[model samples]
Target: MAEPHPVLITPEWDAPATVRALCTTRHGGVSTGPWGEFNLALHVEDDSAAVAQNRKSLLKACDGLEQIQWLNQTHSPRCITADGNSLPEADAAETDHAALACAVLTADCLPVLFCDETGSQVAAAHAGWRGLLDGVLVNTVKQFRAEPETLHAWLGPCIRQPRFEVGAEVRVAFVERFVGPSRAEIENCFSAAGEPGKFLCDLATLAALQLRALGLSRVSDCGLCTVDDPRFYSYRQHNPCGRFASLIYRLP
Candidate 1:
């Protein structure tokens, strides 16, 4: 007789009072089977009606959101300003409008939330390896009207290094571009996996390094690994899995 209260990860940072941010875990929704509770994405072909209800529960939890400006994330370096209209094909979305949440969905990949010191703007980005290496966070930072020092970024749950094995090429692609002190930092992001020509990559560390390079000293990480943490969905664990969302917005 009562709606399931969705379990959300609220960022514990020094963001302004008006700035609100949250990440959903795989708890408290109507989807059955592998989706098992709060799955918010509609594109995975989980029953459309169930997904719709999950979203509705999400909406109820936020209450008064004009819209959750969602993107059709494509692992590209694309970031856009959310207009509260149609869903755009981008890895990131930002909005200055009050009550409109900028949103991105993810399973194993990173979900990054951003807000300015003044709480006047907010953004969300989806950063898979390709998107991260291709500069999706770069594009997201560009959308901010404030200087990098005035911004705060919160990195959400993702596949951590020990659980995220990748080929040597992934390591090369990330480390080769940097040759200074930063190069060593990048190199440290990976460790040789048990198998040859493979390395365990740390997506969150890479994201933080990139963010810090972009001049955001205020970056914070939720320190959650989706694969190791049973509360969130993991694409590597189950294909066609549900996607949890990372959302941020300014209050009206």
Candidate 2:
């Protein structure tokens, strides 16, 4: 039998050979309408059976991946070690174990994948605006005992700056976290949305900034916008949409 060619995205980074990663697109599954196909998330009203089948397809695409340690993300800064069992209620997870996938589900939210230069550790974080401002990326990086300079990060599809209009409080939330010269850097992530109190936020840029702030120099972005790209799911574009999965694991 021929291998199924489901639409998957590989990160463009100089990661070690043992680290494997991919992001699923909304194609090649048994879902219908809003969920379309390949909807891996179960919390978005997608059919349970369809979600199961889609998840199975994802695992198949990973080849030897034993299991994807899924998280019940709540836009918090909590991160846990990926143990291959027990779905933890956290926004990020990391693991140094081979064949154990650390994964996160996202529609418009930014999904960041991490791995060290030696491929001994890998992690995935779901960073919505709230989670980003709350330090989810920082928490994920902290899990790896390796030096931050030795890590590589990949920023996945998310709502772009032009479409991510946020209230003044959203801008304030991030700005309040920085001080002096650093405040200007965080403030640059937001631009006026033409409304009095609204601003356009670049989620990927913000995530990259966070990664760089943690001493990670090699950060690459997929540059795919979930809201503008038809291949991926976008909650901002389709209200009751499903989520795509960004997963990373080590090869044994």
Candidate 3:
């Protein structure tokens, strides 16, 4: 059974009054078993009717949100401009349209919400390790009409550094993006795990670094970890877990 009221985490950045952003927690919905309740992703094998009902409830919970309008999220760097109705094959989405939210679904993967300093546009990106390494955030940033320096971003909950163990190959791949002293900063985001050839990666810090590199000075986070925090879902902790959302939109 779903909770009477769904819990939402609003970003604590300095965005203008015209822009709004939030991330959903796994506390409201009607899926059973591992999905339990509050499961938002339909592709996770949750009951179709229940999922639809949950989605409807989500719309009702959100004051003027028109729809979630999920992307196919292929883990590629693809980002698309959305119109609030078309489901596209991309990992990120952006829009200036009011009431039509841009959203990304995630379990353990990082979901990022973005908006211009003046609140003219907004975007959401699903950044799994692959997508993050592949520049999904970069592509999402490019969709904004505002300069990178004029953007504010909020990092949603995900598997944090202490629990996000990655192979050496992943670290090597990410390191390849940098070449000098800046590379050391990126390298600091990955610490050696107790296990040989494994490293614990700080997904949020890594994301913040990339955003800073892009000139976005106002990056903030929910400061929560998905696997350790029951408020959000974690695919690493529950392999068949449901996905939650991080979303943004303009208000008319």
Candidate 4:
């Protein structure tokens, strides 16, 4: 009601003018306390009515978005085509139809949006550690009919390397999962935290490497850190935090 906080982000990429994308911050919603304002996720124990109202406000703010297909986001590599008629259980979604939005919800996990230079199709992926390790980015690239080189990707805000500390298993996961001449390059994205066996992972850098591995040359990042930025909801900072939305759609 009070100007909706106005924290939406438009990604900088080589996407055509017909492609529309934005990432919402934790402002401009009716939820109270922990959920605070502008929490778009329904699974985070926020009041259903409040979440509904917040979602409605989001729709009003984004022009030319007829419908946004919200996924369950199981942190898997599963991706599907958005039809705007049914809610699916997947981490990524894409659409060629105009005004049908492909959306994903995240608090700390990386949200990656995709589009071809031709502006014919657009996609959004929820790339958490598990999803990223499982190849969600690779699978999302496969969904596009165009060559991977022609597709452009934009990395949204997430937990940065300084705050995202993980166990040794996380480091092993990437090292073991991606073994090659460039494996060391991938390994460089993780560094030992102050604690032994604990490591700080750069999710954005890992995501960029994954995109480059997929032959996508046009990749850009919003460079916003969710944990450090109070404008966003950080699950690591608060267990019962709200979730934000990263969405993309084609304009008619």
**In candidate 3, which residue pairs clash?**
28-38, 29-38
Q: What C-alpha lDDT values do all the predictions have?
A: 0.89, 0.89, 0.85, 0.89
Which residue pairs in candidate 1 collide? none
RMSD of 4: 1.5
**lDDT of model number 4:** 0.89
lDDT of 3: 0.85
TM-score of each: 0.96, 0.96, 0.95, 0.96
Candidate 2 C-alpha lDDT tens digits along 66-148: 88898898999999998988988999999999999999999999999999999999999999999888889999999998999
lDDT of 4 at 54: 85
TM-score for candidate 2, please give it: 0.96
The residue pairs in collision within model 2 are: none
The TM-score measured for candidate 1 stands at 0.96
Candidate 3 to truth, TM: 0.95
Error of 2 at 4 (Å): 6.5
Q: Write the per-residue lDDT of candidate 4 for residues 104-187, one digit (tens) a residue.
A: 999899999999999999999999999998989989999999999999999998999999999999989898895221788778
Q: Any idea what lDDT model 2 has?
A: 0.89
